[model samples]
Target: MSMATYIGLNFSVKLNEDYTEDEVEIDYVFSSEEDRNVVKQKHFTTPYIYEVFEKDEPIWRMNEDQKIHSPHNYEKSKKTFLYLCHLLKELLPKGDYCEVYICWLGEEVEECEGELKFNLNNLQIEAIDIYEKYFIRIEN
Candidate 1:
């Protein structure tokens, strides 16, 4: 048996802000939890982000030459967005915008099981890169 659910998500990442000071801010927004685990897991990385700042910055930070190290924690849904960020860093220069629009949801396919594809402005990145994409559960 196979099933799939389309969930709506919008992610906007601004890299190397051109403001008076250099800053990186990621905006996360999602609606509803198709199931309970989603709610418990917390779709957004806002909490973990703060934790990184308060506790440690090594997980995701830039060095002297503007290089990012270990910027992702391998969260399913969030992976698509982080993948967007990792790619945007390469194409976009300082103060560039990376907007990811997630529109497709797949499940139980092939031997891999699940996969996710997202639109990164003009570019597209799939979760198959890490094979830890988002998967949902449906209860009757």
Candidate 2:
């Protein structure tokens, strides 16, 4: 049997004197523990940076197949958001930054927030000031 959940992502950015916020809600469904495990592993092991810093455009794009799928896939959607954070890093002013939050749509899970910014070298996207309580936990 498949389990269903809704994931919510919210982004707030401060660039110089400007502020921007974006929010997305997703319907997530999975058939088994392995499905959740895959996403969890990628979340812990992958670096936040998706591409080189000098690129002017985002490297992530949804393929035809992804666009045709109903109810966005959880893993793909999460990766897309991560890439967006990188894009935010690129657009941030010298001293500006962005904040991201993740939470379950209807569940009692606590929301997790992280600050996204460039590293000292300004070549990599790094997440700092993170609250570790934010993540999906599946229980049997």
**TM-score, per-candidate, Cα-based:** 0.20, 0.26
Tens-place lDDT digits, model 2, residues 1-140: 31222222222222233322332222232323443333333332221211112111111222233345622543344354455544544554544332222322222233334323334333332222222233321111
For model 2, what is the error of residue 81's alpha carbon versus the real structure, in angstroms, after optimal superposition?
A: 5.1
lDDT of 1 by residue, 1-140 (tens): 21222222223234233332212233222222232124223332111211001111221122112222333432322433344345445544544332121222222122333433333343333222322223322111
Q: Which lDDT values do the candidates have, in the order given?
A: 0.28, 0.31
Candidate 2 vs. true structure, TM-score: 0.26
- Candidate 1's clash total is 0
Quick one: best TM-score, which candidate? 2
Cα deviation at 114, candidate 1, in Å, is 26
- What does the lDDT come to for candidate 1? 0.28
| C-alpha lDDT of residue 91 in model 1 | 43
Error of 1 at 1 (Å): 19
Worst 10 residues of 1 by lDDT: 46-55
